[model samples]
Target: MLMKSSKLLKLKFKHQLLMLFMALLTGTTMVSAQELTINGTVVDESGVPLAGANIVEKNTTHGAQTDFDGNFSLKTSSNAVLVVSYFVSFPKNQTTFKTKK
Candidate 1:
């Protein structure tokens, strides 16, 4: 009777751990699904595409470099402020946009 009780206790503990792990996994997926992708093009004052421009999310490490056509895409949270930088010797530009569900 005592051996049976011990075995049952172990099984219950394992089941509880598995349930906890599954709950955490589901929560992570929900959070990641809320992330948004932003796309835009970088241009110079003369309206010419500026390839290799640096696009970074303000206050975060998320960033991307413009393609040959000055296009860039990055994933970030909603209402993020993006810093668009070009010309190593010049100042950076800031732009803000929000994400939709």
Candidate 2:
């Protein structure tokens, strides 16, 4: 009976450690999936900032517009694709950018 009790205690300790490890792994994964902030500037062919350019995350409604200095910032997941659009006197121009992992 004493030997069996010791073995059961060891097994319970091992199970608790396994559960703790799994919980830590799950928390790390959730943290990685959290949103990340992205910042960039839109520029025209003349190396000038393009103010009021629209920046949108691909496949999602999250977006932001460039300010007067042609700078914009938005939050998205890792390795996201962004669609950028701007128009002046001519037709609207569009481009795509991919965020780094």
Candidate 3:
């Protein structure tokens, strides 16, 4: 009976350690999936800031418009494709940027 009890205790300890490791791994994965903020300025060909420019994540509703100084910030996944455009009268462009981990 004594030997059996010791074996059971060792088994329980190992199980607890395994559970803790799995929990930590899961937490890290969730943190990595958290949203990221991207910031930048929109400029025209003449090197002038383009205010009110439309910035959006391709194929998604996540978007933002440039402020008075052509600066804009939006939250999205770490890997996202952005579509930047001016008014309908102007041209449109697409850009892809990777966020740092």
How well does each candidate superpose onto the true structure, as a TM-score? 0.83, 0.58, 0.66
In model 1, residue pairs whose N, Cα or C atoms come closer than 3 Å (at least 3 residues apart or on different chains), thus clashing, are none
> Higher lDDT: candidate 1 or 3?
3
lDDT of each: 0.91, 0.83, 0.92
Best by TM-score: 1
Show model 1 residue runs off by greater than 4 Å.
none
lDDT of candidate 3 over 1-101, digit per residue (tens): 99999999999999999999999999999987777889999999898999999999999999999999999999987778899999898878988888555
Q: State the weakest 10-residue window (summed lDDT) of model 2.
A: 90-99
Instruction: By lDDT, rank the candidates, best first.
Output: 3, 1, 2
lDDT per residue (tens digit) for residues 1-101 in model 1: 99999999999999999999999999999999878998888988888999999999999999999999999999987878999898777589998887654
Off by over 4 Å in 3: 1-34
RMSDs, each prediction?
Answer: 1.8, 5.3, 4.8
Candidate 3, poorest ten consecutive residues by summed lDDT: 92-101
Backbone collision count in every prediction?
A: 0, 0, 0
Better of 1 and 3 by TM-score: 1
